[model samples]
Target chain A: MADEPRKIAFICSKGNLDMAYPALIMGWAALGNGVDVTIFFTFWGLDLINKARVDHLEIPPVANTSMKMSMMGIPGNLGIPNIMGVLPGMTAFATALMKKKMNELGVPPVREYIQMLADAGAKLYACKMTVDMMGLKKEDFLDGVQDIVTASDFIDMTEGAQIIFI
Target chain B: MPTRTYAGKTVEVNEEGFMLNPADWTKEIAVEIAKEEGIETLTEAHWKVIDFCRQAGLASGKAPTLRTITTGAGVPTKELFTLFPKGPAKKVARIAGLGKPEGCV
Candidate 1:
């Protein structure tokens, strides 16, 4: 039997710009498939759907081989030194470049993509443990978040769904 | 270089069962493949799903994922499970003569 997964769940634990897209894109794709989808944002991943910080999420180009400057039409293999990755402005530069490439490829920005996922009926859950740990309120989240949930609650919501943790 | 005698016609396929050349596909081949997958019957609804998958596969130049079929083909998830049974995406692609879809649970 092909395990034919109809329900999909994502646990987004990272807040970085690049770290966020994997779960977001996959979640969006699941919605496109007419599958039931849910995303649980915890810790720094909360920034992905945070009311005031989503669009401002940063992608650190440090230690990432995939962030090719050449993709931005620079036409060179001059990789950014690991040391430079720790410098100020490097993160912003990388985020801008990555966002531009994604835009060229017709991928929506993080905020819009999250909204699209929600609009497509993908549910969002804020982790209760992290919420309390970070002293966040429900109002800290964007609209369309289904609830604040514990791990057990998440397990119930994810029954029979393929769960991906990022 | 593997092959399968599908629908009494010799067609090339990979070891994992994806058609090596999709042009060899036909409705009769789909029927045989479906039977091999324990789907003894292909109703009109099944045809709708299969046809949609084939067209989407052509457009994308790859196997359409389960999500693609449900979203683009307009088939609901429950109906798809009922129609294709186990491994809907894999089975549908094999029957439709597309490569086995790469991403899944």
Candidate 2:
């Protein structure tokens, strides 16, 4: 076989900003390594590519506290308990802190990041099953998504590729 | 590091290099790289920071500034450190796969 880097596939299932970020991160990592990367957003993970709802993603309480602590630069073992995420103003506090930190670090907001990823040739696909289940129309998704397909189709395409289910 | 069989072949990877024997790079390595840089893992929020950096790197072939990353990550610019105490721009950039950045080595 030629020395070409193998193709990679990412299957994402959740939709919150918390879950959405990982798939995108991993996808870009593969691309960075020069691997041919394709991301298949399934179930709620498809929310990230949804134009109307993409901007509305919020962290669930179950997923917020850890996110809060992590944003504070705390280690996992040292992070705040998940229950504490329900405390008044905690999410806001965490959001504000993270925004400030991002500013200091020079990271861009979501739309720009999505645009950037698209520009880099990251192939994005939506799960047809999820789209039908959600009753979403084709225009409901963002511009970067390449196409929609079944799980079987995704599997077929990912044969021989590094497959990650996020 | 973790190993799995794909198409009757095994690929090895670690934080450092990609190899045939499942090179040892793993989440632990990514976390270690983050921690050594003094970047505390605040929460999923901070991950969004890293996520944004990845998108920027993937989209632009260049690591983005704090403002640009937050914008891309869909969070306000003021709230980044809640997830990355070492600062969003630098820490997330490191985690996003651009280590030491330009001119820092």
The candidate that wins on lDDT is 1
Candidate 1 residue-wise lDDT, A35-125, digit = tens: 6789999999999878888989888878887666576678888776788888989889888888887776666688877766665567899
Which candidate leads in DockQ?
1
Error of 2 at A148 (Å): 1.4
> For model 2, how does the per-residue alpha-carbon lDDT over A1-166 read when each residue is reduced to its tens digit?
6865578778878876556666666555444444677889889887788888787666555554345355576655555667777788766666566556654754444555565456556778899998999998778888878788888988888878888888
- Model 1's chain B yields a TM-score of 0.92
Q: What is the TM-score of chain B alone in each candidate?
A: 0.92, 0.57
What lDDT tens digits, residue by residue, belong to model 1 across residues B9-77?
A: 999999978888887889999999889888999999999988998888888878877656776788866
Instruction: Please report, in order, the local distance difference test score of every candidate based on alpha carbons.
Output: 0.81, 0.61
Q: Can you tell me which runs of candidate 2 are displaced by over 4 Å?
A: A61-84, A87-89, B1-105
Q: Determine which window of 10 residues in candidate 2 chain A has minimal summed lDDT.
A: A60-69
